[model samples]
Target: MKNKTVAAWLAFVGGPLGLHRFYLHGMGDTLGWALPIPTALGLYGIQRVQQFGQDDQLSWVLIPLLGFTIAACALVAILYGLRQPQQWNARFNPQASADAPAGLTNWFTITAIAAALMVGAAVLMASLAYSFQHYFEYQIELAREISQ
Candidate 1:
């Protein structure tokens, strides 16, 4: 049986790899393995765009996919952290005795929750900033072209 704290921490730290899903649902969870595909592509696209230029159309697709994946992972981590102890135990540890340690009150669990929230918020804000910057820069370039 997986501990809630452990699973939540994994999701927060390595969610793109679906490590948390593997821990909770085991190797049979295809989604766990597939979640990283776009993340990898997106990262590669980012590198390509950085090396070449923003005109790299592939980077546009990949970066947005990566951003979406990050946001989804953050949401998953937050949901896992917020799950009720009883529900979590029932879902993930039904085979274990009811008296088994739930680990919900542990310091690690609290820390993971806090970290997920902070990281999620930061990533979300960064994505928004990047989007706005790109949009405004495009507009400025268009205005300059039109004025000329």
Candidate 2:
């Protein structure tokens, strides 16, 4: 397959897994994938604690199910990328060598832009999660009242 075909497939299938990072041979890119592992575990733990306290043992079943589903998806992405690295290299300019910017200002601009985007995304997700949790508690309370 052409490099572009492989790259497209990787983006389609391996995006969430950081497979693209592994494909680029940049382990640092795996940070996006690695960071989520703990988040997944924490989510499951929270769900488990909530279910147990509510005496709804069945909800715990979803913990393992959701965990396995996410893990499977990530694994599939990683495997697909590893299997198609040749395509990835071809699709992207793998030959380009990284060189320091000739000017200090150029380097600063690039770094600043990248950092700003990352921070923005992180803040957005954190706010969304906080809101979701708050609303979820309200939903649970409403359900309890209706049932009572």
Candidate 3:
């Protein structure tokens, strides 16, 4: 197994913003630029949900649910990129092909993570929503039985 570098870890944890790709290409300045969108959207989404009177809900819970989904995807991309032998092996052996094509590791990994997260979130939301709706219906039925 090849030893991993900070760049590899970053890429495996934040590749959706192409940070790993940038770092691999010697563009280290782009490393931290990958966070603004999701961060802003997360804050904005939570605030919007709060304004709708569901303040009882956790602030973090309203983050479009997509933010976590996106972060998870970024993590996967970084992991995928980290898995490529060429990326790590070449780290120690700089004379190795410095310009070979980056594999689908970034794309596929991120996409798969995003898809799975979205599906999971959707299912959870649906289940909770259904339970809440059923609970209200049950309460109404009980009230009618008691009144009758």
Candidate 4:
């Protein structure tokens, strides 16, 4: 049976790698395969920043894909952790009874949820802030050039 805690932890810790999806939906899950693409591009973006400096426009776009993907995964973890046992079992452990131990919420699940929430929110906010800050700065530079 797919344990709720395991899923939650995986989503939070390895969501960018799609580990949770693999655990719950098996290796053939298309989404599981797709999740890493953006993550890889995002890592590439980080590499670009290091190599070319932060002013590389491509990095600005690519880096946020990583952050958003991570945030989304964290959200999935929180959702999994908060699910009622019946609902969780009904969806992920349909072959098992509702009261299956794997479906039950425990302190570990709560901890995963809390960690996901905190980390997700921070990453999301940072990404938005980074994107918007650079956008406004770019706009200002363009305006200055146009005025000149």
lDDT (Cα atoms) of all candidates against the true structure: 0.80, 0.45, 0.51, 0.96
| Alpha-carbon RMSD, candidate 2 | 12.3
After superposition, candidate 1 runs with Cα above 4 Å error: 55-57, 139-148
Candidate 1 residue pairs in backbone clash: none
TM-score computed on alpha carbons, candidate 2: 0.31
RMSD of candidates 1 onward, in order? 2.3, 12.3, 9.8, 0.6
lDDT of 4 by residue, 6-87 (tens): 9999999999999999999999999999999999999999999999997999999999999999999999999999999999
On residues 42-96, what C-alpha lDDT tens digit does candidate 2 reach at each position? 4665576675763444434334433443444444333333433343444444453
TM-score of each: 0.84, 0.31, 0.36, 0.98
lDDT of 1 by residue, 1-148 (tens): 6687888788988998899889888899999999999889879988988898986656766776677677778778778878877777778888876545763647787788888888887877876776667768778989999999
The residue pairs in collision within model 2 are: 3-91
Clash count per candidate: 0, 1, 3, 0
* lDDT of prediction 1: 0.80
Give the top-scoring candidate (lDDT).
4
lDDT agreement of model 3 with the native: 0.51
